[model samples]
Target chain A: MHKIALIFGHNDYTFEIEKNIKSHYKKIYIFNLDGQSVSKDSNGYEIEAFDLSEDWDELRDSVNIDECEAFCILEDMSKNIFLTLSLRETFKNLKIVALSQDKESTDKLILAGASKILPTTQTTANIIVEMLKKPMITEVLHNILYEKSNVKIAQIIVKNAQYFDGLFASDINWSKDYNITLLSVIDENGDTEFIYSAKAKHQQIKNGYQFVVVGFERDIIEFEKLIGGADE
Target chain B: MLKSLLLDAAYKINTSKNYTKTKHFFYNLLENSNYKYKKVFDFFMIALIFSSVFILIREVKSHVNDELLFYNNYVVSVIFLIEYLLRFWISGSITEVIIKQSEHDVMFGAEFNLSLALRDIFYQKIRYIISVKAIIDLLAILPFFHELRLLRLFILFRVFKLFRYAKSIQVFTSVVAAKKFEFLTLFIFASIVVFVSSVLIYVMEANNPASPINTLFEAVYWSVVTISTVGYGDITPITEAGRVVAIFVIIAGIAVFSFTTSLIVTAFTEKLDEIKDTKLIDDIAKKREFYLICGYENISKEVAKKLVQNSEVIILEEDEQKAIQAKKDGFFALHYDPGSIESYRKLRINIETQVKAILCLSHSDVENVYTALTVRSFNKDVFILSILKAKANRNKLLFAGVNELLYEKELVGMIAKEFVGKPVAFEAIHALRSNYNGIDMQEIIINERIIESFKAVADLECHKHRIILLGIYKKNKRNFYFNPTYDTSLEVGDYLLLIGNMQFIKEFTDNLHKGK
Candidate 1:
């Protein structure tokens, strides 16, 4: 049961960001700093409004900043940096994530002691939107966010393995034996080749190959032991 | 020892690299009609056939010089004989390459052994030699055998070879083949009408004293002439019953003629349209890479205009006027609803394997999202880039697996900010956005091969090439290094931002790939 604090200026993106992430948190405290005359409640969720230039100590006390996860989504880069610096000063381990309008501000946000920075670029948004469109991507995202599944991606290097030394990719029963999906292979030349590609199907597996596999953690461990190498 | 030495020499000739290269060249020229030199060969062959026909006709009509005609016939026959032999030699390799290069297993079925492969190649060669084209080629040289008077008739077969040069004739034949059932139905109906009319007239006129149709054959001939509206008048109906039957037959003849003509006309138009569509799809599919823009709005038009100079662009606009305008402006525009699967099917989206990206530039965010979803459903791996107007719709589009998203408001705000504070930087950005004197900025990924070939940044010689290396974005560190030092070495996944003239950039990229 994690409590979250969302700080936003009067921007259309804030509402969308808040709506998408609200379900993951137990309690959400939205602080609107634009001081616009708007509804205090959004679908039974309360929004607290404040002035642009405000006393940080008073706001921190009111929001119980130390006990909550904070999201800084200010529209202006400088303001977002200022808010992040202030939050970092107040609590060293607050786990503050800030939004940046561009690449240059992203560096500033990191320097301001934000635990994470999300660049509000259309490219980033599009990628996320695209992933949400696919059910498989949604399932993966849900699993990662909620810790609902043990499936993880692991890159394992191949050492001396007699069975796999000279066998084509199609000849190997990776999923049946190890419960792993062989996504790709990185050869000795550091070129990544998709396992299912026509060029890769005839490729003979050899030593010094790095395999990127997706499977349960225990199965990955078992596969690593069988291949005589640790996860990269 | 002499036999073994000769066998060794034969093996060397068979396995030599130059021999294989020559074989490949001849195979391409003879078998692959799409080959560049093959067109020239086809034109030459057509010219030769026409000249031979003219000479043959002249010999038949006028008192041409016997020696000149004989010499012309001999030279053309020899050329045809050589071409026939070359085609036969290359047919085996052509069959082998087709089997080896087909991407789908459905075409060739399971792989066969070496002996079976050889047998298949032999069968293919036999089939080719017995084909209509081969018969014509053989007939074109038959007149040279002057001793055989019967073979003189075979010389006319050169006219059949003209079908090879007429692509429309092949298309028309295929259309007729496909509509054979409809044609048979019309033929049966017309035959029934003629037979019934002939029988009725024969019955009515046989017993009439004043009837000219005394025999059934003469009555049938009269019906045939009247039904065709030719009215030969060699036979005529005399009685009232015969006259009434003739009137009905004439009316039926006109109706059936018009119906048959309209049917043929409609079928031809439909078949031609279908052929055009298939040819367009085939041409687009053959392209290795192209950009598919979903809308023909102002932004999309600008994007198409910019990309048209160096890259292939296809626009799918639902608005008929816009699509027509786009075509008028020299862009390939297809009027299709982007959201519908049927439209995608018509476009043969699934078969277009080399589509580099689909850009959804619709004004509505929802429409863009729908287009992205539809395209992704058809092809899971194609990169989808969409322009989003509203921030609220970002999550939906991101979930749809759009690889690139351009926010209109964000871009506008950034440009505005730059314009107010840094005018020079703004101008530079503006210049890069639109082509300024053929100069523009392009971002290229540094792949593993590039990293290995060029160990240091200085080796690229951007200065000598008149190109500027703006910055390098290191993927691993997620850091942008502006104006990297000459000693700095690039890594795999680094993006090199370069500014140069289009031609120079193309050459530089080519040279980089060539490891020059």
Candidate 2:
């Protein structure tokens, strides 16, 4: 589980963000300026809380440095920088993930030693807009990727594949030879379709067949050499 | 005559494409330029793509039904046979296509000397990415022995297919790609969940009465269903003690889902409002000895892309982020943002000549605008481009005598619309009206050394290749214009801010510099 420190601008940002990221992380500490946003999670791991920005010297006196982990600056830019910078000076190993209102804020946050500058809201809408674009492709690709798989979805183009060109699936000894399973092909005209039969074994595949495959990394690399073509 | 010839060439490149040309060429060759043959070819290719999909669906069914497997194999094989025959019938030369990719005589170095015509056939140098997808297309058809083992497995690929069909999925995928480092950890976490849960369930319930949970497969199934909160209950444990352990498993399930969601959220949030996939060139006008500054970040990249491309951009950014972005794009940039008076003095402006523009592209537009104002007080002739973040502060920038002001949010939106548009526009624009996490602008340079000449620019065949010239800023002349015509001469020094078809970006770049 990823360790995340949730810093709030007030209480709301901390509360909402912690609720969202709570499920994904192993441990999350939600802290507002008031130092009391700790809520019971549905799971057993109770989110810890703290707020040093409110009473710097005193709060700094109370919190234990050794117990803390990476931080997520969910609050507004200023307090996010102040608390995060203070936190950084001591717990240098703590990953600082801060949110920025815009580019200027992103710069300030970076100088203050925040590891990543979150663009805050523009990307969210872009994602929505991106979704509205060619939704079918998105749907198909997501289903393919999100599924449980020890294997990665990859493609290999048949460049100058001499041995496998005319050979069909039944004909080419992939299991014995390449150790990569040939899955599909995309033609020169940008048409992608499934490989049908052993017949493809005898007749050579036309130019531009990008083979979809699943296999060990070593064989995939070898197949990529044959199909993905020269990077040039 | 030369001008007219150039114009004619431009027209030819713009009006036709290889796809269209090939279609026409085939029709003419068959001596059936009339309507009949055209329809036939279209239907044939369409059938191939569509039928493959059908075959895949049928094979999915065959996986569960043993008797149906025979028919699936037969039907699939027949389709492959027909596809092969049709390709041979259509293509003029089959051997040339396959053999042309990997034939290498021999290369002594790491870079394979695959360019020579007489290279060996076994290693036909694969030049196109389409070929990899071709193999995938083929694999999608050939019925594997998978269904005989597990039916739930088919849902896996079908889901991927759904995402593949949507535009949002493309954006989602890009956001994921941008944060691949972060996502990899999540993936590893997911893998551990599946692996550890399986072991845990097996160890905990091996002798239990409720669910034997003997096989690793059942453990995997139970884990997935439980984590997803589906709780199919087909393989539930009957033992009371096992129930206690199951609660912990369910909790793990919730954590996994929550974790995965945040990963997507983080990636999307970072990518929002970003003005990505465009190159900036100085605006075209009479040269006033402008200095081109090529680098940008929040201040550097944002402002450089916002200003006119035709001007001499003496890009200054000490940050490696900005410097690297500039170098990868082939635009000239100095490594420094002249924000401070000391930095300005350090520029060592010949003062007498050669420098007539000062663009303070730093993170804060306020700082940049002020820097411009500061620079102008000393050298009034220098045109300054400032990067200011707030729209409310436009007057302040103008008061600074900045020739132009680039608002990161606004510029990101405009650049985004130009590069990857239709579904997604300027992230800045989207964010103001929509629920965007943030907006940013990025660069997509037409790589150096792809085509021998600027012929690719004139050819207009790039769109097919999925690279678009959103705006062309002629570096030599210091002129930039939006959506340049097909004939726009693309010199080595020129930078094109383009929105590449994100999916094909890798393919396009792979073809840029011959691999070595």
Question: Residue B513 error for model 2, in Å?
Answer: 52
TM-score of chain A of each: 0.54, 0.47
- Local accuracy of candidate 1 as per-residue lDDT tens digits, A1-232: 3465454554655555555555556676667776654566555556677654665677666666666777777777888898888778768888776777666788989999988666555323333333323323333423422235555556677886576768876456555456665655667886655554455667888888777665677888888988867543
Candidate 1 Cα outliers beyond 4 Å, as residue runs: A1-232, B1-33, B81-147, B188-256, B278-299, B309-312, B316-330, B335-516
Q: Return the top candidate by DockQ.
A: 1
Q: Looking at model 2 chain B, report the run of 10 residues with the lowest lDDT sum.
A: B277-286
True contacts kept of each: 0.00, 0.00
**Residue range A1-232, candidate 2, lDDT tens digits:** 2333434343333444444445455455445454444465443334445565444444356554344344444445666677768767766765565666566777877888876555643433233223233222222222223223333345555666565545554345343356544434445654433333223333456556556554555666777776555221
Task: Give candidate 1's chain B TM-score.
Answer: 0.59
Q: List TM-scores for all candidates, in order.
A: 0.48, 0.27
